[model samples]
Target: MNTRALSSIFTAELRLLVRNTAVAVSALLMPLVIGGMFVVSGLQQAPAAGWGFYVALMLLTVFGMSGCIAAAGTLTYRRDELYLKRLRCSEASDATILAGVLAPVVVVTVVQCLLMVVVTAVAAESLPANPVLLVAVIVFGTVCSVGLGMATTGFASSGEQAQTVATPVFFVLIGTAIWAATDLAEGLSTVQMLSPGGAVVQLTQLAYTGAPLSETASGALPALGGLVAWAVLGAGAAKRYFRWEPRH
Candidate 1:
C-alpha cells in the first residue's frame, strides 16, 4: 500500500464527498432522517425483537444507500471524470487506489452505525446482549456492502446510472432483511439464513436477544458464513469487471 498516495487520495475524496450533494445526502442525511422517525415512533416502548428490527433496518438503509449505492456512484463519477485513470497511472497499486477511493464511504458508514447504536441504546434504555458480536457483525456487513458497491460499478456507465443499477441489489438486501425478521417455515428459514441480508438480520437479532455464543453457534455460524460468501463474491465480481476508465 502506498501510504502517502492513499492519504492524498483519501483527503481529496473527502473534500469531493462534501461538495457532492447527492452522495452527501445519501451518506449522511437519509439515515439520520429515517432513524429519527424510528425513535419518534415509540422505539422506547418496543420489545427486544422490535429493537432488533430497528437495528437491522438502520443497517440496511445506511449500508445500501451509503456503502453500496453511494460508493458505486462515487466510483463511477471519478472514472467518468478521468480521476481514476489518473490515479491508475500513479505509483499507487490498484488495491491502494481503490481503498483510498472508498475509504471515506466506509468511514462515514461506520460512524453512522456507531451513532445509530448509541441512539438506539439510549432510546430503548438497554444495551445489546452481545456487544462484541454486534460489533463483529457490523464490521462484516460494512465489508459486504462496500464489496457489493465495487461490483455495482461494473454495471454503471455514469454516476446516475450507478444508482439505477444498484437499486435492485439494494432492494433485494432490504427485502431479505425484512423477510428474516418475520416468522418463516423451516425450509425458508434455511434459505434466509444463507442470504446476505437475512444473515445480517439473524445475527443482529441474536446479538440483541442475549443468546449465548455457545448456544447460538449453530445458527450464527451459518449466517456468518453466508456474509463471508457474499463478501467474497462481490470482491470477485469487482476484480473481474471494475473499470478505471468510463465506457463510451
Candidate 2:
C-alpha cells in the first residue's frame, strides 16, 4: 500500500463524510442522543451491572448506526456514482481503497467511545475496571460493523435504497444488543453471549464491572469467536457480492 495514496484517499473520504449531513447525523449525532438520554436518566449512576449495560447499549448504538448503516450508505452511494469503479482504475489497490473508506468511521467511533467513557467517569463516577478489554472490544466491534456494512452494501441498488437494505441487519444487531443487556434465562443468556452483538456486550460488561480474568475469559471466548465469525462472513460476502457499478 502506498502511504501517500492511502492518506489522500482517507482525507477525501473524510471530506465526503463531513459533507453528508444525513451520514453525520446517523453516524454520530444519533448515538450521542442516546448517550445523553442515559445521562439524563441517571443510568450512569446506577449499580455496576446497570452501568455496564448502559455502556454496552451506547457501544451498540454507535457501532451499528455508524459503522454499519452509515458506512453501507456511503459505499453504495459511491458505487452508484461510479466512484468505486474509478478508484479501481487508479493506482490504489483494493485494500487501500477499502481501508481508506473505513478509517474515518473507525476513528470516529473510537473517539466517541473514549468521550463516552470520560463522561461516565466524570458524571457518574463510573470507570471501566478493565480498560484494555474495553478498548479491544471497541476496535473489534468497529471492524465487524464495517465488514457487515460492506456486506450489506451488496444488496443496495442505489444510495437511496441502501438504508432499506440495511434495516434488517440494523435491527438484528441492535436487538441483540438489547437482549444482551437485559437479564435473561441462563440458556438464553448463553445463546446471546455467542451472538455478534453479544460478544461486544460481554466485553463491555467485563470492562465495566472489572470481572476477574478467568470469568471474563470464559464468557469472552464465545463472544470473541462470534465476532470473528461475523467479520469473516461479512467480509467474504462483501468481496463476493459488492457491486462495482450501478444496476440497470
Candidate 3:
C-alpha cells in the first residue's frame, strides 16, 4: 500500500543487484554453464526428451537455483551490512521493506525465463508445445525459489557464508525435483509422484500435452502439496526465525 516506499525500495534493490556482477549473472549464468556442460558431454544430443527439452528444462533449473541464491544471498548481505536492522527504523513497514527487496529479484527471474523461452525456440528449433505450462512452471518455480531464499537468510550468519549454507538445500530440493522428472516419465508410481521435481515436470508435461488435470492427480496433488507446504513452511520459518541484524 505504501507505493512511494515500495518504489523507492525497489529502485535501490535494482541498483544494488545489478552492481554486483556475480549476483546479477547468477540467474542467467548458472543455467548456461550447466547447459554448456551437457553440450560438451554430448548428452544434449542424446535421445532423452531431445536437446530442446533438455535445454529448456535445464534453463528453468538454473533459474530456480539462481533465484534462490540471490534471494538468500542478498538478504544475508544486507543483514551483514546492517541494512535490514536500519530499515526497521524507517517509516516503511516490515512487509513493505521485504516486498521492495524481493520485487526486483522477481522481475529479473521473469525476464530470465522469458529469455530462456526465446533462446530455446531459436537455438534449439524447438517449440514449447504448451506455452502456458512454461509460464506456469517458471512462475511457480520463482515463487518457490524466492520463498526458499527468504527462509535461507533466517539462518545465515553472514553473506560470505550463505552460499555454503544454502547450497545443500538448493541442490537437494532441485536434485529431488530432477529425479522425479526423469524417473516418473515412464509411469506414475506412488513414490515417483512424491518427488517435487517429478511433480513439476509432470505438471509441465501435462500442460505441454494439453492433457486434462484429472490424469495428473498422482503427481500433481502431492507435488502441489509439496510446493505449497514448502511455501508455507518457508514463509513461516522466515517470520519465526529471521533476524534483522548480523548474528555476530
Best by TM-score: 1
> Model 2: how far is 204 from its true place, Å?
1.2
**After superposition, which runs of candidate 3 have C-alpha atoms over 4 Å from their true positions?**
35-56, 210-222
Candidate 2 versus truth, CA RMSD in Å, comes to 2.1
Q: lDDT for model 1, please.
A: 0.80
lDDT per residue for candidate 3 within 1-248, as digits (tens), equals 68999999899989998786666666557766765564444344644454433543554465455767777778888888888778879999999988998888888777766665566556655556556556666766777677777777767787656655666655765576567656544754555544445545555555445445566455456655555555566567667766777775
Q: Rank the candidates by lDDT, best first.
A: 1, 2, 3
Least lDDT summed over 10 consecutive residues: which range in candidate 3? 47-56
Listed in order, each prediction's TM-score against the native is 0.93, 0.90, 0.83
Better of 2 and 3 by lDDT: 2
- Model 2 C-alpha lDDT per residue in residues 47-102, reported as the tens digit of each score: 63546667777777777777787788888877788888899999999889878877
Model 2 TM-score, 2 decimals: 0.90
Model 3 superposed RMSD (Cα): 3.0
- Candidate 1: list runs displaced more than 4 Å: 42-45, 48-50, 184-188
lDDT of each: 0.80, 0.76, 0.65
- The 10 consecutive residues of candidate 2 with the worst lDDT sum are 181-190
